[model samples]
Target: NAVDLGAVLEQFSLVFCRLKFIFGPMALHALDLVDLRSVLHITSPCGRSTYQVTGSSGKTYTCYKSCHYCSCPAFIFSVLRKNDSMLCKHILAVYLSQAMGACQELSVSDQQMCDILLAKDG
Candidate 1:
């Protein structure tokens, strides 16, 4: 099950199958993040949505599902600059969480959501 990630395993099997079939190794990495409950789906009062995923290093990165963009350095360096990957693990995690309904959802005020968007990750 680990190799090729073929044959659905336990828990979120459908999402795992889809990710493995559609993405590559990073999809597997995303599953690890998902298992950690790293993905958070936030909805503002006005219905605007945002996502955040914690990386292995314990840093949370913002993810934009609409653009398949992430604030993680991996996304900037590998996906945008080096053109070595399609999406970062954080972005992949978000996708996996959404597909599996595994995300930890939060409801926040529009102002809070705006602050999250503008706030520096550091």
Candidate 2:
């Protein structure tokens, strides 16, 4: 038996909406603002599949593209633990950056990551 992919996607959308409600409006709003150019992607020397994303707030979070994993709380609690395939804002931002060819890629050893972290701490 063939399954209707559209229907499946629609169901997923409903679940996403419900999850968003449970999480609160902040997450949804963040997702909406993900298209901003301020999102930065830092590449790892190990490979290009993993990145560290610096959002418009200047806070950095790690994103593993291969596993759709992010270190952000939204991804941890709302997506990973819930087994939701829908990405959080940071992940979505990275995807948007890649799709728009706007991501600034820097080598892992460039100290950009340290700079971002220190800036966040201050």
Candidate 3:
């Protein structure tokens, strides 16, 4: 994966610095997801990777590492529309997963990935 942890952490701190204290609780939740190993790193045979996380609600959310996106309502309402924060807790979990090497890697076919991504509900 060649991801430099230091660089990723630096970027996280830099981006999150702009957010307010309201998002503080999400950090703990993100760390919990990482510690619990709820993050999944699914890769296809072609070397493309996709990120997904299981929330406390027992639903899986698709997270995009390439564009820093998550298919979570908090991300859409708070992070994007309201601009309450730069990233969702799930996205934070993704970053923490990368930095801590806490993700469960899975190999799936392109068709499986498509089915997973196109799913309306997890």
Candidate 4:
């Protein structure tokens, strides 16, 4: 019996497209899951405002507070799905935003901010 090559090709294409939609972001998200220690709190204009939320397995995450702004691939996906989910970056942003009031001294250094966060964590 002769196989319908054209029909098989069309079905394959459909399957591939669907898979791309499902797997593309997941693959990227896996990449996004990095070590918390890797997320160095570089001094940013936002003011020493960054930290990593590491999972038990050491997968670090950063959440976006806004739709167009996210530190991680998962944030973008959550934003697209219209879910207000908390990620490591988002929590850090919140902590820093609040910290700004407490650490308003002009002389405060970046290290001080880290100290503040560590203190609060304890």
Best by TM-score: 1
- How far out, in Å, is residue 113 in model 4? 17
lDDT of 3 by residue, 1-122 (tens): 34798888888787656432546888878878888899999988877778889998988999976887888888889988998788998998998789878899999998788876763558
| Per-model TM-score versus the true fold | 0.80, 0.52, 0.78, 0.25
Q: Put down candidate 4 lDDT per residue, 1-122, tens digits, no spaces.
A: 23788888888688546634655533233223332223333244445554444433455443222323444455556654656543334343334334333212233466665554452322
* lDDT value, residue 35 of candidate 2: 45
Q: What's the lDDT of the predicted structure labeled candidate 2?
A: 0.62
Candidate 4 or 3, higher lDDT = 3
Error of 4 at 33 (Å): 15
lDDT per residue, candidate 2, 1-122, as tens digits? 24788888889699658747754554455445454454556665544435566655666777765667667777768777896547777776666567658776666654555554333322
Over 4 Å off, model 3: 1-23
Which sequence of candidate numbers ranks them by TM-score, best first? 1, 3, 2, 4
Q: Give the Cα error of residue 6 in candidate 1, in Å.
A: 13
Give the per-residue lDDT of model 1 (tens digit) for 1-122. Answer: 38545554544587667778878788889989999999999889798888988889998888865788788888889999999788899887887788779999999999898877762563
Worst 10 residues of 3 by lDDT: 14-23
Q: Judged by lDDT against the true structure, how good is candidate 3?
A: 0.83
